[model samples]
Target: MTQHLANFKARPVACVTGATRGIGRDIALHLAAQGYDIAFGFRDEIHASNLQEELVALGAKVFCQPLNLFDAKSINSFFDSLNTAQFGLDLLVNNAGITKDNLLAMMSQEELEQVIHVNLIAPILCAQAALKIMLPQKQGCIINMSSISATKPNPGQTNYAASKAGIEGFTRALAVEVARKNIRVNCIAPGIIETDMVSDLLKGNEQQAKSKLLSKRLGKPRDISALVAYLASQQAEFISGEVFNVNGGMLLR
Candidate 1:
């Protein structure tokens, strides 16, 4: 049984974390247009408002909430709010993450802990909460955002890469657990996408980055969002427990 707003026609619901910018924002927009009422979490108030307005304009019911990835209460409270609204969430996109890059020897304890907590632990917690909703419904999809760094690790990104690697592992294990329940779990590992998160590195090394990619250009947010939409759809019902790389062939398996 799909979830619906109390007074409106049934619309599949999606809850996305870190939807204020970059790939997260693009996914929210794309899903809203795809006929899913979107309930999103964001750290930035202004950007969240803009996203809410846009989603409404797209003719979708929008639930925008503040999220502090660092705080467990905030994460659970957000899901609680979603459940209270009766959105009947059909998808959860764990797209929020941060990078604190430094050589392991040079990285501070705070940097290491915060990076792992925000990038890895937060998504797991979000999924745990979402399952409370999904399992009972007998239908749902979870799409986690990992990075190519997980496999093709660079020197200073030990923490970032490790966190993403953990996410990939979590996806596989969780997928197996819930596959029998008709709930799918999958992860997407993106290449160097053109987003604010990687702006500084992409700026000076544009040519260097392009040379390595078979696509010869940096990825746009839409590249990742497009795949996210596909994985959330019925066509991908057979796909789960897999990590899809959207890295422009940056590191081929």
Candidate 2:
């Protein structure tokens, strides 16, 4: 069950996956601050518990549980757990992803499948479930997280690139199908952000990372989270089926 404010019963609700840390964690906090009740999936209770406390402090109702993105049933169960009648599902953010970097010649079959399943398939299933709830309400927004790698491939990230590319395509096509229902789908392509997921690439070399971007600075989690907040708000009602690149002008071509 979720802990909530007394008057939270009427607030908008959003479900964000892979929210235990990094971009996902910040997005959840940002949404809560913006007055949206929050729901998220996690693999670690410690992280989930900490996040729950943070959300509650922001006057938000939180629905969170352990989630295994590789399993379809698990994904469905996460969405099912939300109380659609009481709070309403207004936004879905598919921000969970993984990267197993290795040269294609040395990459394992298992590696490819794991990355693809979590990064790509998981979001498709999430959208499928969220759409079921949104279509009926005739008002919802789905924001899929993609990466610059989807367009500008990096060495030893073939699987990661493929998965993210699929997400971009998925957002566009799905947005068209649900546009008439007033449900908008959009994708975000973040350049290299300073998060644990990509800390290895950053590796205490802020100057080096900044050198590669036109902004001459590494992107922060809040950079992406800010756009997410806008995209989920009424101000972005007219925006959909598009991808916003938040990589400080990183070269994608």
Superposed on all Cα atoms, the candidates' RMSDs to the truth, in angstroms, are 3.4, 2.0
Q: Model 1, range 8-85, lDDT digits (tens) per residue?
A: 237888888888888898999998899888888776777887888888889888776677989999999988877766
lDDT of 2 by residue, 137-235 (tens): 889999999999998878999999999999999999999999999999999999989887678676778787788888887899999999999998889
The CA lDDT of each predicted structure is 0.88, 0.88
The per-residue C-alpha lDDT of model 2 at residue 63 equals 77
Q: Which ten residues in a row have the lowest lDDT in candidate 2?
A: 1-10
Residue runs of model 1 more than 4 Å from their true location after superposition: 1-9
